[model samples]
Target: MNLELGKILFTAAIADAVSNSKDFSAFVCQSIEKHKTCNWGDCDPEDSHQNDLSFESGGRILSVYKNPAAHEDSEPKIWIITEWDRSITTVLYPSDY
Candidate 1:
């Protein structure tokens, strides 16, 4: 059965990426714009040269439910995700995960 993530805003936001920083936010935004789905492998690169950021870092999280009706498409959303330990947590705007 398909599960609904409840009342969570599944929006995309671009986080600040510094030089040599693992830019998971960038990946999330790119993935959402490209696939409309969030997966760890979405940003994974098989080659070291192509490698930059991995979704495993928990930096970029998928919003739980679809965007709220009042929320405009141009607005970014926040989401709750099940972490490695099977716990629900909120990702802060400036958080790495």
Candidate 2:
């Protein structure tokens, strides 16, 4: 994605990780509009919330493979083992991946 959308995604991730109230979470709703495939795994509907955790980041599809230990945890901690197609600008925010 473009720089603005990347920033918005970063902001939304921070919001998702921290916010407690519904009002606070609403900001991310608009921010992620550019990302057509914005998936939050357990946080969204359809009950296919577990197992595969994937989403769009910086215009590319991002997915995480869960280990047995990761699945056992309450909150799934993510680490970017590798990427598909990435832009140079996206590297600045390593924490996002």
Candidate 3:
């Protein structure tokens, strides 16, 4: 699957961690791959308003959802978020709507 980084708002410490850890990057990639096969209901069953999908890999949690900025009638753009532990969550854009 194709993946792209969005408006990344990482803290300095998290930035350092990302730069220093190849494993984290790999986990993020794996998460994206997992996101490809995930159905909307995979993340939460009752939360039907948002079609966010999530999966776990290498002790990290990753999610993919529709980009809020995209128009309702336009082609969908997917946003990816990888949570490395509890403190760091990286957001990405897989495609532009």
48-89: candidate 1 lDDT, tens digit per residue: 112212133433333322223222532233334433332333
lDDT of 1 at 11: 24
| TM-score against truth, every candidate | 0.23, 0.22, 0.33
Candidate order by lDDT, decreasing, is 3, 1, 2
Cα lDDT of model 3 overall?
0.41
Best by lDDT: 3
Stretches of candidate 2 exceeding 4 Å from the true structure = 1-19, 34-97
**What TM value does model 1 have?**
0.23
Going through the candidates in the order shown, the clash numbers are 1, 2, 0
lDDT of 2 by residue, 1-97 (tens): 2222232223345445436545323433432332223332222343223212322232333323222232242234332222333331111112554
Flag clash pairs in model 1: 10-63
Clashes of 3: 0
Worst 10 residues of 3 by lDDT: 48-57
Error of 3 at 36 (Å): 3.2
Lowest lDDT 10-residue stretch of candidate 1 = 47-56
Local accuracy by lDDT, each model: 0.32, 0.30, 0.41
